[model samples]
Target: MQESVQHKGVTHFTIVKILRTFSPDEMNEFEKFLHSPFFNNHSTILRLYKELKKFYPLFSDKCLTKEHLFSVANKGKSYDDQLLRKYLSRITKLAEEYLSILQMRTEGIRKDYNVLLQLSRRNIKEIYTRKIKKVEKRFNNFQQFEAEHILHKHFFSALKYELLNKDNQIKPHNELLVDSINNLLDYFLIVSGWLLNEIESHSYTYDTGSKRNAVVAPIDRNMIVEFVENAISNLHSEDKDRMIFLEMVLNDMKLSSPESGFSAYTNLKKLVYGNSHKMSRQILQFYLQRMNVYCLLENLRGTHDMHLDLFQNYRKLLEENLFGSEGKTNLRFLEFRGILISALKIKEFEWAEKFINENVKYVDEDLQANVFHYGYSLLRFYTQDYSESLSHNSKIQSGLLPITIDSYILKAKIFYVLGHSDSALSLADSFRHFINLNKLISDFHKQNLLNFLKYFRAIIRLKAKNNIAKAGKLLAELQTSSNTREKKWLIEMTEDLLKLK
Candidate 1:
């Protein structure tokens, strides 16, 4: 539609996005769905669907415009503007209906479980019993803690649904049944509490990082944190090996202390490594996700040793064929960044070089340029290829302002290292101005970066004037700052200047 590009492919693109996101198999299934009279009855809608398929992989304006689509859809019949618009509307609804059906079919457990709940509530005894066995079987097939817990939701729901039935002659009040029910309720209470904390934490994380409009949820801050903490403490004696219990512990650590989350991170590693084959793919995926989050947390905290642990963790996930599946780039992209940083942290240039070249191809084309260049630039910089480092990072164009501030700090360091003192000083000044003006950049980050810029500019000045004595005084002042970025690297450079005498 020529209505507005603002809501088009780059943004919303409603029906267009749904169709283009389909896999080859999904597209075929969608075609069958369209042909089935149960989903679509209008001939014009069918014609519209056929016309849209021709623009697959790239639903460009050439064939996607309403004029062309209407012209082709009502070939022999003259196109009535009103009729054409109705045809598009009907076809759009058909596409939406098809997507809903496909999602349920692909993820069938939730649908069947919901139906089981409904059937149990209606006191449809025979069908409810049959569905119960089927649901239990499906739930049992899942080895992930999330699956068990999700099923536990349904399990407890079904138990309550059956319990409420007036037709039930006798209530089974067995100890194991009652105990199991109570435990699941407790586990779910923790899940609910942890979800609340995560929602609140994101509010804080974003509030400190960006100027984006945030919808504040009205809730007590301290109460939820205390609830989750007490829940975890109460549940810790819970089968320690159980996944839901482990997740609650890890999530609490992630929310409260990212650096301290390292211990929780190790516990998750043991669970995955020891029981991956016994676990469902869903649970393995969840474990990998948490591990990566912890990896990032540790990296942000400047914990240097975790660099090697992540290298092995990513390698193991890849070996299991779980790291990147179905051509997804988001996870692979995170792993790429993590591996690159970890490798550079320990100076494993050979492995870093191989990983960068091989893994960049897996990154989505839209993101590869900006994302990989940032990693490659770091690798190049660490390997002493200063020129190429600047060349690669020049194209990085870090998207987030906070990350951009760090990139500028890196660029200044590169310039100084390459003996471009004037450019380095100019860049430091530009960084100071940008940080001062950007209200979006949090005060915490601004102060840290300001400390970096001040000490960095001082070092550049002293080196330029061949004043080693003054450089030492500035380095001591820089060391005293409460928080500073690139502390070790800055100290190393300053010490090098001191050594020249």
Candidate 2:
């Protein structure tokens, strides 16, 4: 009799989920990893892995039945549920180890650090001294550095000092301990600065008037700002520029409003342009993300024209390939959409089209269709090809919440422009229902979209009536509204109404 097709928890196993994340190359490499005697000794686990590999990528329901797995992996042995479970568990552990090994290969210093620890435990003074000097040399010769490097330097110093003082036959190096403390403080200041930036960025969500949930140590942000400024004045190291950029970011965060943020923003842009080469890719990418956030915040305030600034920021990131590892782009769908929209906002049609074609492939395969259609639809809409725009927009069926909301909004805009008032208003109402029913969208975002719909309905009505004064009033409200999405487009639409009269 053929085995029953029930999955019986095999397909949904954690091993299957982990395997799904592996690329084709990784899958083949994992097979070799399983064959290594050092990593895996169980033959049945290998057999189980072979059975699992038959259905490699999907491991669909019918292929992952418990009965089938047991029979195939243990051809002659009688079915024992506990035994099969043990084999599955063992293989999952092996897979996890393989992943760790992969990570370890990329971090060579981590391996040496552990080796130094092992040497220290054995009190192999001669080899330990030689290895410590080698590692310190490697660290000194390193051209690029991260904040973690400072911490690692401190760790090595501590280890060296301990080794020297272990037997107390000779005095410890007092200078080494001081050097370690200095490195520790540098690490603390850098990490604390980053954390402070994050705290201030999200400070809008907190209610200061609400009762406290717990007693926490109060941080004086102004004190840190003052200390950082003082340090910048006295700094003479290679890290002077990096420290200066951190101070600039902190200053930008200190600005009470987006209107006042422009000076800080300009200073930051100039500093990055001059010192990007001195920074590591990780640091540069992180600060670029913050710069983009500042640009977006200022743009939302409706005072500064930041589209060109945003366009340049994205161009730098893309040119440097900082969004992904190994010289390839791997943008999340939302990030891809934001970049394309930024290019569109600046009317860089040719560059935007080329960017979409070049980078759409970097988005996950499942999201590629929606990203492609949405990008082309925006491009078509901007270039005034309404019919083609609608055609591309209709092709997006990803069921992703943001894509759905954007698709509906784009459809409504196209219909309104084409004089299909009834269809346009109907879609706008449906969009409202979608927003109200969905709990996934945060209150902040929900309010933004609802505000857009409110202004959208007003613009449609104003166009039909050709009320020039009301159009001007609508434009003014949209310009000043801080909590609305699509404010720029709505303002332009309302301006078109004034021209109509």
Candidate 3:
């Protein structure tokens, strides 16, 4: 598990991995752990440790070959793979055990709780009782305001009760712990129901109009709906700062009556505005991400006024460093791309340009250029600066499936808008060929994009001669197929075409 990927034939991974993560003091302690007869009786494990120690921090294969280790382990005897594997496994096992114990020893609560349990086993009743109380006292001094903190406290308290029960006379104070655990569970399930609702709604929205939505009652649909609705009016019943209740309400509104989603969004904004500092970074990111999702649903339902507001929210959160690293991660360029699009959709052209230029330093150096060019190209296209868009398009050289697909489609869109119908159709055919030949994309994405390209080529050719109604009809068939990229855009395009006609 420590190795990033499995090297099936490479036997050095287990031992090299152990050494790679060790701190200097930890490595020293591990040396002692290796020498101890209690932990290891074989001297060959020590030999392996000493040999592996020479390459600590960067345990590359140059000096770490299995055959070399076998020679060192068996005193230059004939190389034996089985003998080599046996000692390697033995050393790796001891290294893993040592780290586990070391981690336990460094954690105050766990270390102390373990000692108390050991004392209980020794029948040292007075010391065990005192130590248990001390452990409880220490845990009490912790900041147990969050649900996770309370849950962990409850877990430890229950474990203490289990240990105490082994001696029929001893008992731990676990009644309040049980209460806390139940309350925490209640909070998690209710808040987590929002996540479940979102997953189901995407499927639901496919059947209904993106304009219509309702909360599908969860298994306990009535209670959950009532509890979520009541929590909005009675925020005091649960601390919004620690529990994710407002997001739950938002999800409920998005499902139950998305016409009410904007109201729920307002409620969420107020709650987040008041409690952003009280929330942890992870929680804040989560709240903002849900708001982004709410904004997305609103956009799908044709709420464009809030676009700038949501764009400003992205800037505000990015300014405050509230977004998680993944929002800016180069690995998932799509998320970062969404942020750029948010700014672009609101017509924050300068801000989007500035962001692409300034924020790319956070991306992996290898990927920064690719992300920037892909994003800049879309920004240019959306702003209708077709030549600049084409420049950015030429600069894109990324092989990532999402980046590649968007780049190809963006070039097609630009050519269509620029009255280069011949170029657009040519690009679509080439893009289709490239997609078919490439295995990097999933079949689902491949099919959707291919379908989109087909319709796009048809629509582009038809619309050039003021046959806008024909273009609109071409897209109406798409409404029944599983939705593809730019469904809302297609709908809006169809509506706009019909308007012109």
Q: Please identify model 2 stretches exceeding 4 Å from their true place.
A: 1-10, 23-32, 35-37, 50-65, 167-179, 185-224, 233-242, 248-260, 326-328
Q: Tens-digit lDDT track for model 2 on 1-501?
A: 234434364767889999988889999899999999999887878888888887888888564678788988889877787787888888899999999988989778888899999998888889988999999899888755467677888999888888878857466588889879867866776566567666654443222233365333366556666766776776657766446655654564554344456776777777777777766787778778778877765665556678899889989998888998856669988678778888999899999999999999999998898899999999999888999999999888898776887888889889988999989999999999998987667565677788989999999999888889988998988888876777888888898898886
Candidate 1 per-residue lDDT over residues 1-501, each given as its tens digit: 535632233213467777778887877777788788887877777777787887786787543566667777877675466786577667668778877776677666667767866886687878877777776676567655555455455465547445445466465546436546655755654455446556643543333544575555454435554655665566546455453444544454443454555565666577667777765555566556556555544443445336667777776666566656544534545456666776787788898888777777777777777777787788889988888988988887657554486479778989899899999989888989998987775555566678778778888888888798897887686555555667667778888899888
Q: What lDDT does the true structure give each of the candidates? A: 0.66, 0.79, 0.67
lDDT of 3 by residue, 1-501 (tens): 623232233434666766776888988889999899999999998987888777677876554677667777778588777787788889889988997887676466656656766786688888877777776787656532343444556556665666657667445556755655655655565456556656654542333333355455445444555655565565555554334544544454443454566676677777766766565455566667667765655553344345765775676568667644524433346557767888887678898888888777766678888888788788878888889988988898877776777888887877777778899899999998997887655454566677777767767666767787676666667565442555555555556656767
For residue 360, model 3's alpha carbon misses the true position, in angstroms, by: 4.7
TM-score comparison, 1 vs 2, better candidate: 2
Worst 10 residues of 1 by lDDT: 4-13
Collision pairs in model 2: none
Candidates, ranked, TM-score? 2, 1, 3
Q: Provide the lowest-lDDT 10-residue window in model 2.
A: 202-211
Candidate 3 similarity to native, TM-score? 0.68
Error of 2 at 120 (Å): 1.6
Provide the TM-score for each candidate, comma-separated.
0.79, 0.85, 0.68
